[model samples]
Target: MNDFDIKMIKKLILKGQWLLSEHALDKLLERNLRIVDVLTSILNGEILEDYPDDPRGHSCLILGKKDNKYIHTVCGFQNKSLVIITSYIPELPKWIDERTRGGKYHE
Candidate 1:
């Protein structure tokens, strides 16, 4: 992913949108966004193509690193895809938790 993609990803994150397909998401980001972090954790290694099955369903995980900050990108299922961003895994971003309650999309 390039700088442009990063910006798009960040935009989507703020807007509470999750890309259903990783490839599609990448294409969208590549065209309009920029990388905010030079060495992001999300781009560190191979992105998990598949997610595990759960109550909330499976989701691919991507990590973004900015300075010492880490953003967790949880890309959920196709039918009901989700993105939960957090500086830390144990504690989710306050907004994310509030929005994700009851498994409903944030408004």
Candidate 2:
């Protein structure tokens, strides 16, 4: 993957405030070292994927982007994180943006 993609992936892994799958985490590990670097930076949190929008669960894939602002990923050795994207709340997606519209409360 390119630097930008790696960066975005890192942002998600470092900032995503949701639950991340161990399987996806494995895929992320295979991505690139730079991606691992970004993940190492935080040392906290993990990647989070689909939720309300994904009723069937199959619709849930890697990480769906609402506006392509920010993606999502997993972190932590145990893989513990939230389902809400905390890194780029305002500029990530409409769902996240609307959920965190107050910039204080989360949806």
Candidate 3:
């Protein structure tokens, strides 16, 4: 495992060098989340966990705030671009809280 620089990630996001994964898009749509929300969450967010060797690619879980609520955004760096792998509200058995993991299903 390795760490991704939050500054670098922020830069990538700011430059529009980012895109959503198919699954991320679906989740965003299903949850009624907009791209702006993701961007805001990332730009103003912090890295909660890093998945430097994610099979999908090198990605990390970010915890960010959007309108006073917390949202999780998983971003991956691939081909010099940031790929939003997935995102969701931190809740239930999967998450103990906004910044803590609880269950076995993490990602």
Candidate 4:
């Protein structure tokens, strides 16, 4: 939840020290998104939520913008590298808009 994790993630990403899990890769392909998009988003985005106590590991939801479009990325750190847990374009019902959540998704 703190800035350190996000900073570490950004650092790892900037240095090409990140990995995309199988699930994350699948999500990216399904959305027709490129690694560039994910990296760009992470680099330009801000952390909206943090999951420091996730059973899986510490992670966060980052909302980023590019060319007037929005993308959301879930990231975590492991094995001294940043892991892309998942990424997608936030959509209706769940998102009222790019900056607002329409529901309590974590709960």
User: Model 4, 1-107: lDDT tens per residue?
Assistant: 33445677777888999889999999989999888888898888888888888899778899887677799998887777788899989888788888777876624
lDDT (tens digit, per residue) of candidate 3 on 1-107: 23588888899888988888899999999988888988998899998887766676677889999898899998876678888888899898988899777878664
Please, what is the whole-model Cα lDDT of each candidate in the order they appear? 0.40, 0.34, 0.85, 0.83
Q: Clash pairs of candidate 1?
A: 3-34, 3-35, 4-33, 4-34, 5-29, 5-33, 7-34, 40-65, 41-65, 42-63
**lDDT tens readout by residue for model 1, 2-106:** 122344444554565544345534633654323334114444422423456545554454555545554445554343223432223212433353124122333
In candidate 2 the C-alpha lDDT for residue 31 amounts to 47
TM-score head-to-head 1 vs 3, winner: 3
Ranking by TM-score: 3, 4, 1, 2
Clashing pairs in 3: none
RMSD of 3: 2.4
Which regions in candidate 1 have their CA more than 4 angstroms from the true location? 1-49, 77-81, 85-107
Whose lDDT is higher: candidate 3's or candidate 4's? 3
Note each model's CA RMSD in angstroms: 12.2, 12.7, 2.4, 2.3
Off by over 4 Å in 2: 1-20, 33-51, 56-71, 74-107
Please name the candidate that would achieve the greatest TM-score relative to the true structure.
3
lDDT of 3 at 34: 86
